[model samples]
Target: MASEPQYRALFLGAGPQMQCGVGQFTRLLGEWIEKAEPGSCTTLTLTRSEGSFTEIWGAVGSARSVVCNFPIVAWKRVMFTPLLAMAMARLRRRKTVLIQHEWAGLHWLRRITYIPALLLANTIVMFSPLVRRELAEDSLVGWTAKKCVLAPLPPNIEAPAGMAASDLRRRLVAARQDGRLVIGHFGSIYPAKQPNALLEIGAILKQRGLRPLIVYVGSFIRGTDNVEEEFHARATELGIADDVIVSGFVASDHEVFGLFGAVDGFCYPLDEGLTARRSSVLACVQAGRPLIVTGPALPDEFDHHARFKELIDRGAIVLVPRGSSADAYADGIVAALKRPPVQAAFDFDGWWQDVANAVRAQL
Candidate 1:
């Protein structure tokens, strides 16, 4: 498995069939690198059939360095590919960098599964201090910190220059005009994100005689868990099934942001609370609407981020106490409605350039 190095970096990623924020980030970053210098970066988005060790070995051998992002959609079986690729890279004395978005955010099993890969990586990149704080609890934290670098993730999806009114956006805006609260949740719906918790908040909104329309501008991530089924079942049990809208995998940024424009605000009640790595929340924040999210677990959570620092300061991002009940969350949603829209702008393109540069420096 040998070839003349033709690329500056070879990015190992998942295919489009699995839609997740990390997947988008991986694609965007690779594209950005390729655009900056044509033929310098190549992305290997492996389908199920494409995960053979030979394919990974060839891809890694063709590049000066290998870069892999973790926990992609449907990564259950496919996760082994990148793990094996990085390990193989080490055995061959090749450079391999592991860009870990979050540690404790994932299930314990996933954290344990990634240990070997992390150990093999010549560089360990983290998006936020939250990951660092949590990794500190583990014995490997000391080892990982030695090779770690911090790089902030740009918004995975940014609003277009203009919000062209779409049919759905018009309808949602109409409902808002009629005194209904249009709540939105973006990105793939998974259990750790607690998307169904929004349904609980919506149900509470319903009982109080407030007509709430819960809009999910994303698809469900099908996995071993019954998260998708349970989400639907809960909406049905709470008598809000009809009120729930699931926009399965909207590919257009304009369309997605148009939906964001329609909602009075966005709700992301993540069980892990707000962290720098939540690019989904960052994308929603760019819509200028209030974001009702679980508050940070630590006081200086966003200290590393200047953009979020401004957003939180302007009251654009409302923080609810962690471990709050559904009733409390419902109240937070109502209170967020009264805040003025955020006029501050986020420089997504600049952020991308920064992230790309940081990654290249390590590679």
Candidate 2:
């Protein structure tokens, strides 16, 4: 075999040990990039609140020596804008790619502090066109759009295993003794994630004669652990406590994929519209389960993305308006259930290849 071409690229982001979505993305994407271009890609993990800015500077300086040296230095976490600004000033000779994960994190109060740093970066990678548009509307940062790259977030988890990989499917089926359809919501629970909407969906389904069990496959966000308790309380108030299942954080991606296989469909309701930054959405797509996503308006750009449009064309994802009446939500779910499993439409590996190419091209 031709020796894997050697190249080195620097990544500044959270590592796998951080246990958060950005960290997971950084870890998995870095590994995938290296696999695609062997011996390429080095990462300088971001400092948690516990570490000093000076310490991070030391790490960045050390990582710059790697030969996969490219003109672009990609930074994944935008929350560290100040540090990013300082780093950019020091590494002025190199280009930078700033990947923004959350729309809210770009709030003026927080963002204003880093506006100068953001504009200085070579490329602004926004996960969704809406976010990119929103950023463009901002007077201080709108000009950054000249260099913005719209790369949809790709699924990062291992592909879903065959039914024989686990007994989860059988167990879920058995749990639904009355032929209940179990709908799942994966990823950490947070207000924006809309776990409460699942209750409304379940109630609507029940009234329509299809028993629905809402399963939460991930844990509540830290500092909001009580959110799970509140969910149960709300479910009880709605008189469907037994139908709601909360499975705290699962460590193994295989098990996570197994849970995805167990569900009849994956329901994600978010106010932000289905953006590319959502790894949970990516997970559902990889699971190949019918997807029901409730969000605000679907941007025209979404249709422009060939990959996402293909997923929709294959009946893999169904979009419902955010805050739609329970009847509307229930109707979407029923329609999604009638669709067959999308076994072959997804291009999981192709996404990694694209990511690798982008990194190389930028470098």
Candidate 3:
């Protein structure tokens, strides 16, 4: 590989050890950036204990550009605050871009740190318009909002290696029933996923005299609530336990997408509503599967957005309100199943080009 001697970018976030969304995003982005500009990248871990202030300072001092992919949510504030302060103090000497992955700044305590970091960075890359709008309300962040750009999270999933969806589907069902309609939910088992909503959808399908099987494609997160147990208990209560298939964690992107391809439809009931940041949603889009998504809890601006309007016009996604009753979700899912499958396509190269252009403009 040819070395790009004069150009360097430092990425700070979770590495492979974290085994979470932030870790995956950080690693994937760093890999792509290095491929784009060989020998011009440095990574300093943030989620892992190996991350040191000395290492961060050393990289920031020499790199032409730096990207901090940090999660500033309240639960993470304790860990992120000091590290962020250390990085920001030295970032004034280089072109810095902060990838704010979550809407942590919605809280006052977190915003006190977030606002100054936004001001110090040369640019900000936000995941959703709602977060961007919230940050823009601040006079300081708003003044520089022109420098902020929106790059929706890309799907980390890929088609399974040499494995046909039909073959995988047969294997998945060998121990279970073979004739039921498979409805899949991917990502970590969390309340935000609304597993209970899936049971409700199943109950509705049963009422309509159809056999529906619920399939979970991800593992449970430790230290959080016992969502998996809760999901099972809820399923038993709904009398759909026998029909549920939990795959635990399918590690490979190939297997994940193969499972996705095998499923009849995908349902994601996110508490935050449908936004660009949900990689699970991106995964569904990549497979071109029929989708049932939850709408924003409150009246919001996304309805007016061109991208969302285009999706609705194409019948690519059906939206039910956040915290909507199971019946409402079931209705949305039923309607989604009836629609012709629309191949939702993403241009990953174009997306990365936009990211590269943003960084180069700052440089």
Q: If both were scored by lDDT, which would come out higher, candidate 1 or candidate 2?
A: 1
The candidate that wins on lDDT is 1
Candidate 1 stretches with Cα past 4 Å from truth are 1-7, 14-20, 34-40, 48-59, 71-73, 139-146, 162-167
Across 114-217, the per-residue lDDT of candidate 1 in tens digits comes to 78777888998887887877776677655676788777667887778876667778889899999998999988887889887899999999999989999998
lDDT tens digits, residue span 22-52, model 2: 5656666677778877766666544445335
Query: Which residue pairs in candidate 2 have backbone atoms (N, alpha carbon, C) closer than 3 angstroms, thus clashing?
Result: 8-68
Error of 1 at 291 (Å): 1.0
Q: What's the alpha carbon RMSD for model 1?
A: 3.2
lDDT of each model, Cα atoms only?
0.81, 0.64, 0.65
- Clash count, predicted structure 2: 1
Candidate 3, superposed: residue stretches over 4 Å from native: 1-8, 13-15, 34-40, 45-53, 71-92, 104-122, 133-148, 164-168, 171-177, 296-312, 321-325, 344-346, 356-363
Give the better candidate number (1 or 2) by TM-score.
1
How many clashes in each candidate? 0, 1, 1
Candidate 2 local distance difference test against the native: 0.64
Rank list by lDDT: 1, 3, 2
**Candidate 1: residue pairs that collide:** none
Q: What's the best-to-worst order under TM-score?
A: 1, 2, 3
